[model samples]
Target: MASAEIGVIGLGVMGANLALNIADHGFDVAVYNRTEERTREFAAGAGELSSKIIPTGSLEEFVAAIRPPRPVIIMIKAGDPVDQQIAALKPLLENNDIIIDAGNANFRDTMRRFEELKDTGLTFIGMGVSGGEEGARFGPSIMVGGTEASWNRVSDVINAISAKFNDEPCAAWLGENGAGHFVKTIHNGIEYADMQMIAEIYGIMRDGMDMKAPEMAGVFDAWNSGPLDSFLVEITSKVLATGDDKTGKPLVDVILDAAGQKGTGRWSAIESQQMAVPASAIEAAVGARSLSAMTGLRAEAEELLGRPDLGRFEVGGNAAALLEQALLAGKVAAYAQGFAVMAAASKEFGWNLPMPIIAKIWRAGCIIRSRFLDEISEAFTKTPDVANLVMTPEFSRIVKETDTALRTVVAEAVRKGLPVPALSSAVAYFDQLRRARGTANLIQAQRDFFGAHGFERIDGKGENHGPWNMGN
Candidate 1:
């Protein structure tokens, strides 16, 4: 009967919730999972929402359930699975039927898929869905990358099912082909840095100050009222306050120290490096995760080198306040680097990515959502073409105000032998960025001396290379 307004493939955590969200918004959503049992189970569990959910057992049934010029969301694992799904769906879908890849896909893959489907008349959207399971069940920040026509066709449903900030929908067509996924990659990279920095601060509080989890939770809860009011901070407080069921200790203490990551953070770092934008904080965070996974190696190293016992951690004033400011400062640096990478990517891809709109949508329904993003929206709105985000007046003031705190925090952490790679990288990034003339001249000279690669003469001299003696 083609009664469903949209169709969702895959019944994973994200896909199921997204389908429910669509159905909750008064739209009939046809759903299909590779395993028919899961699809039936989802429908049975939907309860009241089941009326709006069309459970299809096969791809043909799923395709037949949707209306003409269908908008089908492929919410499955990325890479080859996505390609395989597309190949399977091609013969079934008609011209103008939209296929949306709502996965954590690499932008390069998105671009390649777009190229492959250009002549097929099947509109492809590389979408980036943010916020976790809860957000997916309610609403998420949706980033769509596709043709304007395709976006226009689906904007109603997309807008209806997206999170709102002050009555504004947190969904937008960022750019063509891979733009949405690219932004999402950088978003995750920033998330990595944000989380790592927070952990570093918690390490200081725990190991240095010998503070308990509940006490730290109180401080984090307090910070949530201030500039650090974000989803991550709010959750951090909750996680710290939670007690373990078995041992009655803080839940965090009983948990493993290691962390796992998908490829998005690494992609962000790789893309930033390829674009010649220094995202040291993001890189450091990635490296830290890799190191964390080496549990045996870390344990062996600890046994051999011994934990640093350099005495009580000291700051001139309130350590908590200093840590807060330092966190804020590190966040600014990480965000600046992320935005700079996006800026470079935009140029390289000719996406003309809207900086303010990106910040605007991120203000809600995303992991990194915060009061600071609202400020970022304003800054970018005022100075759209600024060389870097840190150069904006609002962020510039923040960096300056928090500079001393960040310096003190990093200095103390280093002295106490606390691992603060991400935070320390933020400091080095800021220092290197602010320097008018860096030591790169010596690097150029060294390169020229070794390979005769040539260097630019500062005073407009004739020869570019140094006349180093070959005999020496």
Candidate 2:
């Protein structure tokens, strides 16, 4: 099986798992790693496909082991090391060979590499893989970007190992050149927003209603059956139910209230700003993570910002009831933000990334997958240019009825002077859209004030760009 004869570099958590997944799919794979032992250990234990996995201690051996016109996937980190690895491997690869960089590469870098490799008679694809480590091993959402001409030469092999959504592989030769990484970059951006929104809901339960994590987790579990259901909610339920690993105490309190982020979150925020996507939730999350890394600074702030009292939520009412209701409302808000980002990305990339296709792909193959994704798929298929997620009647209704309770939750928490960025952002977005007045214009005014930048004036007659009134 030419499609199955392959080599994988970098046996870190993601690489190792993916190699094993490929082997499990009955592929002949030669696995290599910077350190020999990990590769040996993983290959040695291979069960049904034990013979299929060939562990190579030497990089040369790994290169020689593959058949001619070899297909190799570099799962290493992006940047210099990638070029370094390719330089070492290039001499070993034959003409008409293919190289797949299945890393979270910067799109521009991907484009540069594409140009560099063309003269060598080699095919290079920058593929974006989502679903993290687990996704890598089991099934993953994959996006490929390269020449359409080469896709016929390589697409079958690439798709074979990718996760399926609605029985279609979550694999597409996204478009020419840098498109793969571009899609993946935006995917991570969406993920950042989604995770932060979930984090916000948990905060509301803990600080606003004073409900516990396990209690909140249960609410998420129930929500998994509804229109708002998703993998995030399901995992949240597990997290809430889980107790402290050390002392067997409820784990929620022990977990630092702060969040952490890799660079992808920041990339999304930056890209959104560049593309003018108005990615507030993602920006807020990235900011939240930046704040998280400063643990001591946050600790010091505790003296200035005390906890909120939402005892009434838990005192008389059932915690699960309150949380489930609130989460349904919150998910709607989060998905709305995600859709908005995707819409903005479509405009930026000219991909016209069908939201229905995106939602369908996520249903089974992504971290954000859930029953709710189905509704999202339907919404987008019905209306491709959905302005915002909550604009859908179903979602709008949830926000409408639940906003009162969520607002009370937000207000009560703010009374205690706690910083709930995600929750506040969601609520603010809700109010901003529902209200006749939009503060974005106020923001434009402030920018024009300092930078002498132009602003869109909402004059009594109509909206138009009015020059900055710096003269006054």
Candidate 3:
């Protein structure tokens, strides 16, 4: 007789925590790792939940522990490792057994794996599991994409281990094959933009306004009680206020300025570009990270270019309020761009992604969880067909009200020679989108003149070529 309801492969932090979470929910979970020592360690450290978990020494034993039509959850590193694990497990699994990838694998790879495994009588699920170690141990925001029948088999366990918003589980079956990973990719892209914009505001507070880290932390704390309330902002406040135990200096002050990435943000930007969607804020955020990585080049450039006298510039007394408003506006733009990319991809790929459901799931356990998402969820719930988020009444009003503040912040950043690419890009995107007659007509004419690319007329239909009088 099969001993466990589900089996988890990989005993890394995420995988171990997730397996323990399943056991905590009263499900019998079988755990395995490449190294048997890690599995032994996890089983030994499982505390009260130890009895519910079975530690397996081999892949075959792990497979044998689970019930028929077994669900094997893979939580290994993305890319080649995931493929390797799948190949190793395929022979051990019986027909109708399910393979669920709960890593950050690319959507295309997920789709390919789904196709490759279909004939072998195994169901493949690309699941995007977010909310770090703590969330994994308690509850996470789960985005799953696979066949309906396959989802039905695993939905109960997934729902039990997911965060809840208004009594509804944060886990949802997004669509077929790759939709889960694709949505997760976009989530990270939005996260990039959100973080960059916050950093830009913090830069203004630190450099332009000459505020101390603790003072800035206080401001962030205040914002968390209002419209800006979110996981990132809340943690940012704590990070800024934290002091180094040895030196008694603000922890953030002692930390390095260099940022690191794991490619999800870059992938989102690339997807947006390929789909012809304007995700300028997300692109700018990715560019900012790339620029941050070149520390030596920046140091050399600063020496060569000569540092400007930033002391001469003075930001106004309402800088904090201005920053809050500006950040809100930039955030709206960033989310709008992310959603637009998703909409375009949905149409292209026939995913039929539910915008409201996406927003709802993101409200609790995800990194980018915020009160603003609650508003967004409501907007989509009311008008599911809204092409752009900014086109919705609530978002439009927020953007319009915050428009002047955004302009002021960007103008001040430019005047003080402070880099605010994400903020500035958001402003530019908003202006361009709102413009009735853009300069694209001139670009079209230039294209027509140089490459014989026909231009569309304003009044008439069809592409028309311009007659250039060139001296022969």
Candidate 4:
């Protein structure tokens, strides 16, 4: 017997697709939107003979359409509207009914709402759905957080509807309380970093070697033969050859340098800072985006700025190939920064989120899904307690072997006056580790001069002391 008497609210692109997907799986689905016309249209259109997709005009009718203990999935915007929807649905749904918020919501808010609704005996699940509108209709990556009882109640529907990444559905029990939203939050952060990495590759190609889109696309395609193979890279090839919309211009030269960001990108940056994890690559990329969006100022800067000139690449030569390889290296570092942020958050929140499961979840449908995810998935499955993504042996080997070329790439980019934010940040991370400077020891010297702090002696002679005189 199929227990998929699921109802979906907010039939925007996401909700509409999700409803169709569930119906395709033989679930008796009842969908409701704010408008009657749309509700009627989609039902008439997608509710073919193969599937049953009922539509309702209002909340009462939508509620009435489903049976008791309904597993209603909410796909609307987060915050006040969600609260309002719950209030409206409260009058109709029986106690112990499970409400799943499949929208991208803040974890704290989910926790608060769960407690608020607990008294009514209605279960609230804060689920993070990724893979965009397409994934929602087919299968999307889904991260869930709530009480065990609430999660178990809704697990069957979620698993059946969610798209598969690798061999598993894009779903997991993230943790207790606010863990689901938190994990989703980090997932978005990783996505931001990954996208920015591909953009940096384009910039390096365009600036360092003056490669066009098609030319660079070919190189990216070639790179995709190996570890650098990725969804973003594959798409970059299409975006390049597709050209610009109005002018039929090669998109490389036609598109504006300006980039726009949604709230989640900014949120990820903010949260990483709060958690004290070095999300430098993503942060730098965000900064680069903000600067790019200031078009007028950027245009003025372009006029004022002189292009940097580079004579040659002597570090094993082959500047062109080296630039491409370095871009790949930066891609690795950007992912590292993102994983670091996630790891720190996981530790802070006590989520114990499985990295391999997450990597598998992202391998197919999400924006960050890439060939690299397979490697990560393997590493974490073997060693679930990985301290960082970069520490994995294969990843470390790739990085260490190519570091010289990677450094050369960043140097050339700096010389060419290109904005390779993620790339530059990536190289800086590698350099920070390569040279083990005792910055903390130097800090102690400064602290001793100002605050009379004690210092350790290296020579085994000098009293192990600071509070020495501060000379003008």
User: Among these predicted structures, which one has the highest TM-score?
Assistant: 1
lDDT of 4 by residue, 337-426 (tens): 777777787788777777777777778767777788788888778767777677888788878877877777677667766667777788
Candidate 3 — what's its lDDT?
0.92
Per-residue lDDT for 1-472 in model 3, tens only?
A: 6889999998899999999999999999999999999999999999999999999999988999999899999999999999999999988989999999999889999999999998998899999998999889989999999898999999999999998888889889988999999999999999999999999989888887788899999999999999999999999999999999978999999887889999999999999999999999999999999999999998999999986655633546777788899999999999999999999988988889989999999998888999999899899889899989999999999999999999988987898888899999999999999999989999999999889999889899998998864774
TM-score of 4: 0.89
lDDT of 2 by residue, 144-188 (tens): 788776666756655777788657877776676777777677667
lDDT at 363, model 2 = 71
Each model's lDDT comes to: 0.94, 0.74, 0.92, 0.77
Q: Which is better, 2 or 4, measured by TM-score? A: 4
* Worst 10-residue lDDT window, candidate 3: 307-316
In model 1, which runs have C-alpha deviations exceeding 4 angstroms?
461-463
Q: Which ten residues in a row are the worst by lDDT in model 4? A: 306-315
After superposing candidate 4, which stretches have Cα over 4 Å from the reference?
Answer: 1-4, 47-51, 306-320, 434-437, 444-472
- What CA root-mean-square deviation does each model show from the true structure? 0.9, 3.7, 1.1, 3.3
Once fitted onto the true fold, the runs of candidate 2 whose alpha carbons sit more than 4 angstroms away are: 1-4, 304-325, 350-352, 390-406, 416-418, 434-472
165-244 per-residue lDDT for model 1 (tens digits): 99999999999999999999999999999999999999999988899999999999999999999999999999999999
Residue 27, model 1: Cα distance from true site in angstroms: 0.5
Which candidate has the highest lDDT of all?
1
